[model samples]
Structure formats: structure tokens, C-alpha cells
Target: MPPCQSSQSFALDAIDSLVRCGVLITEENPEAAPVCDFWKKKGSLKWTTTDDPYHSDSDCEEQDLCSYKISQPSRCPDMLFFLCSMLAGHLRTLCWATMALDLMNTPLAEAEFVRQIHSHLWNTANQKKQYYESCSEEAAHTAVRTLIDLGVLLEERQTGGVFLGVSPLFQLSENRQKLHYFITQYLYS
Candidate 1:
């Protein structure tokens, strides 16, 4: 629900910013319009965009006319950070393992990532989907490579195909905590 509210705020902020920046402006205010109608009443000569060119803040007081404006959070945040923390190390580890086994560091577009993630799930479970004719070969290859690079799983290039090298780190019964420790140390360092 909070994320939904953020999305709504982002959308309205976007519209106001767009109109203010002259990226997208309405020629005439509609009856159902939410935009500031001062421009329609006055003229374009009276408006001035604020001083900052890089970031947008539309609180200019010099002009009576303006594009629609809204107060936006200076740096809008996403819910993913909270969600990721809730997952903690275990979830990141799981994702790392699965992604390594499928397609690590493979530059796939967002849609491709979703599709590859589903395929990775199937592969990890060793289950076959009815329609599973093929999977994202590139993503899978990339994941295996990532696993190797991250030392999560060792890899051996052999005849016919690649085989997993034994990973003493992951093989331990206390692998999760150990992995968390190592990952934190490495990432933080």
C-alpha cells in the first residue's frame, strides 16, 4: 500500500514536473484538469523555471503563472531496500546461489530477468514444466559464471560440459552464517 502511494505521488509529481519543464504542457486546461490554470489565464512570458537545472523544484515566486506544481520529497525512496533487509542474508544468498546456477552477471533486460528467474526456479527444483522447451541459455551461462566468480560454487571446465567444483565453504553445515559473514566482510570491506 505504501509502495502504491509512492507510485501515485511519483506520477502526479511527474506530470507537474513535465508541465513545468515544458516537456509536456497542455495547451488549454480541461474542465477536469488538475494542472495550474494560471498559464491559461496569463501568458508564457510570465513564467520562470527555478534556478536548478539538474534537479527540479518548482517553487518560483516571481511569476503569477506556473505549470502545475507539487512539493516532492527531495530524494524519493523505494520499498525494495526495506524488503531486501527483511529477506536479510539468507534471501540474498538464495538469490545468489540460484542466479549463479542459472545466469550470473548476464546483462539481460528486465523482462528477460523475470523469465530467467522462473527458469532458474525450475532448474533448482529439477522439475520440468510442460511447456519448457528451452530456457534462457545465455542467462543460465551467465549465472554459472557469476557463481564461479563469486566463489559461491567452484567450476570445472571439462569434456562435454562444465562441472561444479566442490566448494568447502558452501558444503559446511553452517554454510549460511559462514556465507553471510564472508559476504558481509567482502561487501563491506
Candidate 2:
């Protein structure tokens, strides 16, 4: 399988594991164990982690199989730090991230945004139904809005068209790190 397919596979396996086991453990600090051990063991995905002991506070559990509750202690507080991929199963955000990375540090135009994303998804996954075929203009807009709300993307309105790129709200170094981490965690798993 391709790299992108492998990542999505890992993500699917993670969802399956959580649904089956009802729990996933982690360390108190997110940086200590960025990826949960349950995912590693279940998906056989080589996710990086520190040799830190798991703490009670990091024990995120599913309150009920019927629905997910944010109030549950098993939902780690550090999860709030995760990007769109972690919180949502949608692939649009990952597509946007892929487009930005393809720009090689340049800005992307909003006019042809969906096409760019579609091309990236197609090239990476080599699948029609799951990648390019599933992408839509509405999904792209929703993904952009999600990133904008999270302060990860900036939208610029010009005379002819709009542009999208890393938000100026963060320092250059911080922006680079955040983008790198987001892509690495989701697309490269």
C-alpha cells in the first residue's frame, strides 16, 4: 500500500480498536506519547512515543459505545491539541494539508482548491472512489473553515480570487512546526 493508504488504514484500525476495546491509554503529557499504545499494537503502525509511564490522567475511555462524550475522563484533555484528522474522520483536511505541502512553501489559490486536493489525494492513494472521486467543493470549503476556526489557515480575499496559506497569527517557527506535525501525524501516520 502507498504511504497515504497506510496512514488511513492505521486511522481506521485505530477507530476499530477504540470501538472494540472501549479505551486507549496515554501519558499525561501529549508530547510524551503522541500516539497511543493501543493504536500501535492494534494497527501495527510504527508511531513514535516516549518511554514514559502511563498515568491515570491520560487514561481516556469511552463512556458509552452509543455516543462519545467530552465530559468523560477517558477523553484526554490533550486531545484538544490534536488536529482535524484526530477529531474527525473526514479526509478533506488532510487533502488541504497535502496541497499546501505540494506548494513547496508557496500559497494556494482558492479557485482551484478542490482540484488540487483531488489530485493530491489521487496521486497519494492511487484509488478513485476513496480519493479523487470522493472529494467535493463543499468538502474543501468545510475543511478550510475548520482550519480557519482552529487558526491554522489564513484566507485572503483579493480582487480576482482568494488565497490560502499558513496563518500569520503564529510565528514562522511555530507555523512550520504545527504544519509539519499535522501532516506527519495524519498523512504519514
Candidate 3:
């Protein structure tokens, strides 16, 4: 939920987003059963019976319903969407996420985020100071505005330029949890 510290550190990769979101488990776990009849419906996720070797210690031996590690194998693009949804769902618990993605297929909305990335491509050192100086608040405003429109980032003030926080579920990824803590416990606390 913490504002991307700087553009360089921000990742727009959706696959990375999935990995960050932890493709291990999600609310839709129950929907992936093989004989459950519900998921067997057309357009439902194609899931086959599986025996997960990676169920955590928290798993129940008796009706261990989470055999998802098999249905949605790792390194697949289709799994990214599901994982992203789950991560997005978890993030919603804390706050709406306003990510500045550097997407491979799509474009980033914020000019400042993009420009900052360009600066990184040109010069990696002192990137933060340079980005702040060269980047425009207007771009951040535009990006934030677009995100609010897309439901990715929510605006704290409709007339101003202060961004709140991203979803806390993003913390399931690498530094996301610490970033959330930094925002809630330190920065905004």
C-alpha cells in the first residue's frame, strides 16, 4: 500500500504480481474441485484431480480441499489472472491498491512513473533525487485519477493530489508486507 518508493523499484509485471500475490491459496480454492459439479460448469476454470505435495502444516489432513498446486501449475500465464485476482482480493482487505505497473502488454497511466523509469534507464545512481526533481506532480495526479477510474487506485481527496495506500494483500509478495507496515505503522501512523 505504500506508494511505490520510486519508479525503479516499482514492478508492473503481472506475473510478478501473481508471484507477489502468492498463487498458493485464494478464496476461489473451493471452486476448483474436480467432482464438485460447480466448477465443472462451462467457462469454469479447468481443474483436474490433484494431490498436492506442498500443503502447509496448517492444512487439514481430513478433507484437505486445497490441492490447487496441481490444477494451476506454476509458470503459466493463465494462472497469473487467477493469482492476480486473489492477490487483489487480499489487498482489498487493507486498502485499494494503486499500482504503477510497467506492464509488458499495456501502458502505465502516470507520466511521472514512466519518466522516472526512463531516468533509471539513463542513470541508475541518485535516481530518487533526480526523479523527484524531474517528475511532475501533474503526472502523478493523472495516474492517480486514471487508477481511481479503473478501480486500481482510490483517491483520498477528489480535488487534491494525495494518494492513500495500495491493497495490503500486495504484501504477500517480497517487500509488499513491509511496505504496508511502513505505511500503516510508520508513515501514516
Q: Residue 159's C-alpha lDDT in candidate 3?
A: 43
**TM value for model 3:** 0.21
TM-score winner, 1 or 2: 2
Task: State residue 179's C-alpha deviation in candidate 2, in Å.
Answer: 4.6
In candidate 3, which residue ranges exceed 4 Å CA deviation? 1-134, 156-163, 168-171, 174-189
TM-score, every prediction: 0.28, 0.39, 0.21
Report the C-alpha lDDT of model 3 over 71-102, residue by residue, as the tens digit.
34455747645554544423322221222332
lDDT of 1 by residue, 1-189 (tens): 356465434654556565565444444323532222223333332333333545333334454333432223335333334444554433433444443322434334433444555466446445533213223444445544555554545555555455564254444435534444444432210
Determine which window of 10 residues in candidate 1 has minimal summed lDDT.
Answer: 32-41
Report the Cα RMSD per candidate: 19.7, 14.6, 16.4
Go through the candidates in order and give each one's C-alpha lDDT: 0.42, 0.46, 0.35
What does the lDDT read for residue 166 in candidate 3?
A: 33
Question: What's model 2's TM-score?
Answer: 0.39
Candidate 3 accuracy as lDDT = 0.35
Model 2 lDDT-worst window of ten: 63-72
lDDT of 2 by residue, 17-136 (tens): 554443444224433322112233243333322233442223354222122212213556444335433534354445444344435343567656545654554454454344443344
